[model samples]
Target chain A: MDNVSQEDYLTAIYRNLDEAGEIKPNLLASKLEISNAAVTDMLRKLSRDGFVDYQKYKGIKLTGEGELYAKNMLRRHRIWEVFLHQTLGMPWDKVHDEAEKLEHSSSDEIINLLEEFLEYPEVDPHGYPIPDKNGKIKKSKTVVAITELNENDTAKVIRVNDDVKNLLSYVTKIGISLGKEIIVKDKLEYDGSVLMMIDRKEVNISNKIASNIFVEKIK
Target chain B: MDNVSQEDYLTAIYRNLDEAGEIKPNLLASKLEISNAAVTDMLRKLSRDGFVDYQKYKGIKLTGEGELYAKNMLRRHRIWEVFLHQTLGMPWDKVHDEAEKLEHSSSDEIINLLEEFLEYPEVDPHGYPIPDKNGKIKKSKTVVAITELNENDTAKVIRVNDDVKNLLSYVTKIGISLGKEIIVKDKLEYDGSVLMMIDRKEVNISNKIASNIFVEKIK
Candidate 1:
């Protein structure tokens, strides 16, 4: 609780729970790049502090208090990312790391003021919805990955998963960003690559990269 | 080294050494609101770590490396204060505490970028010169406390010591801020109060408050 690594662990657990509905110690150790023994020690401590429900053999789950804390951290992180991207003109690829550092030190007052300063942005530059002060996030429906779309279908880019900086830079270089209209011209069966028309220019994207982009179909 | 308390100790030592050319353990203990024993223990550790030249009977002095580290911390703290007051429109009285929290988490890259964003301000909102990245500070000459000026003397406000929030709020309410021109009208000999004219209006300030405001005589 005194260091950023502890916060990272809690957030990682929250993310895993959100994505997969459960957390395994081995998976957490890999995610954090720490050894399994170290992860066990931390999990034991977190369990003792009532931040996690952890059993030696069973998996892990966040308690109510733990979920609230993780959600607040996420809120701070996304708000800062938005500030860096929109206000400071930082590249979307560059905002995540800076926001990660700033989030640990931001107080509730600063976060609220920043939220007001940014005029209550609903999502970050990468299109991830920011959690509200009360830890409630508005779920987005009717959005599917670009890789799921059929050939000749057109869609409007909604969000891009920002887990990789290189992918974001690549996407930005190719003019694939939020609100851009893209048409799937063809899907190569040989390598799973896709040919798309963005801004009236044809571009090729690998299936891996295409899956990271979420879009809403254009009527 | 991992927590803000450690940074606070180093900066406090640097400030004392800069102001008085020496530091006593008891004085440092009082300044930090810790016990003498705790101060001694921390000093011993700092000495062993080569950050301070601590002797059994004599006082302590920062090593060259320690001085640099402390200066960097000061630079970050002052920069954040300037950002909070100037950019965020936070009340000057409320900036110091927020800056204290932010300085620890700010990385070197962020500080440099922020300095650019702020147009490389030489001084913080309180008028204290911010140290450069190399830990070099420009010393201001011809500045003296308002209490030292005689009646009928006019001076331009330079900087106010920002250690006390109530004093900062009171000065702001009285329209005394950086670059304001003030003329001393009268000095109350019995209680050491001074009546001054600011913005074409007269205001009285206590001797203690006057001592904290530095100003340069208007030739």
Candidate 2:
């Protein structure tokens, strides 16, 4: 429909569902940084537009049509993000904000050209799978939190759980990225800090930070 | 001022001046693909805003202040272009359009972050020098046209003179890119086609196409 506002709501719902396995109004409000009332208002609008199934107070989820719409937006967003960070040489943290604006503005002609230019990258800078043109995502659920790894377990960083600006700059400064191998050396119970080896250097990270790091074991 | 529109005009003027060494209204109109009247209108606006110097029936050029603004815009644009193509896997031709939009929208904070993320790229996807954050360009100006090359002369493809959509795809299919080494092997005087070697493969390119390729001799 090219209704940007509606698409944003649908995409937000998709992200919320992906994270929570169910869309909670309060969580939606938090994620979008909008008021709970605003979320409710939008949910009603989305339900009326046939993009969501909303039951007041209980929660909401995307309809089949809504999921399709949301998935497309997500696909565009991630693909653009990959284009920005990988091809454009943008920092991982900076790409999200720029892509947030661009994903909504891209035309099919440009997106198709970009897809070919990037050789149809399957994943974004954060290692999130970029859905194919038809909205088919390569099925994958392999995500390991850094905090759970045993000593000397080697893994490649995959994706981060959040897009908070401060956190992104913090992690990036330490030189960790997708496909960057890290070995867990020790986990301190006292402060939830973990010692890990990254790029041949020992680095200590907090449990809160470790939990946010999604990784895959090195083969 | 971080106005996107102003930044676009400044960047456009800078690019035009760099290539031609002088900016003519008609030339700018052609480069921007706008009408002469539109160019005149914008020139007036830019002059009034202190980004250009215009004189009746004469040429246009960036003043010291305007040069600073234009170079700043260029720095942002080229840096972002590098980020898009290199890190995100975006195709070379596809990145310019996106970078055009983003170079203006980014804040200094984000641009600096991107520069660091990309490890401070020297040239963009198009092989144009990316002005440093302080606005100094690592200078190189050795222009060689495809039409002038003789057999056995080797040069690196620097950039194309145009960004037309069909032309970009066509050139890309022939495997030309900035920094790609090409060697002229034969020139057909009849049809003005040049047979060249790219890496190991032989390619015959039409004269019409060759005229647009901007290259530099391999040192």
Leading candidate by lDDT: 1
What shift in Å separates residue A46 of candidate 1 from its native position after superposition? 4.5
Q: What is candidate 2's CAPRI-style docking category based on DockQ?
A: incorrect
Native-referenced Cα lDDT, model 1 = 0.88
Judged by DockQ cut-offs, the docking class of candidate 1 is acceptable
C-alpha TM-scores of all predictions: 0.80, 0.55
Candidate 2 lDDT over A56-122, as tens digits, reads 8876878888988888887888877886777657777877877777776665556766788778888
DockQ of candidate 1 is 0.47
Best by TM-score: 1
TM-score of chain A of 2: 0.90
> What is candidate 1's lDDT per residue for B88-195, written digit by digit as tens?
788878888888878888777778888988899999999999999999998875699999999999999999988654888889999998999999999999889999
lDDT of 2 by residue, B1-219 (tens): 756666666777777674545688887787777799988888888889887888878888887888988888888888878876786677777777777766665666667877887888888887778887778988777777898898888998887853555666788899887778999999998999999998799999999889889888875
Q: Each candidate's root-mean-square deviation in Å?
A: 4.0, 9.2
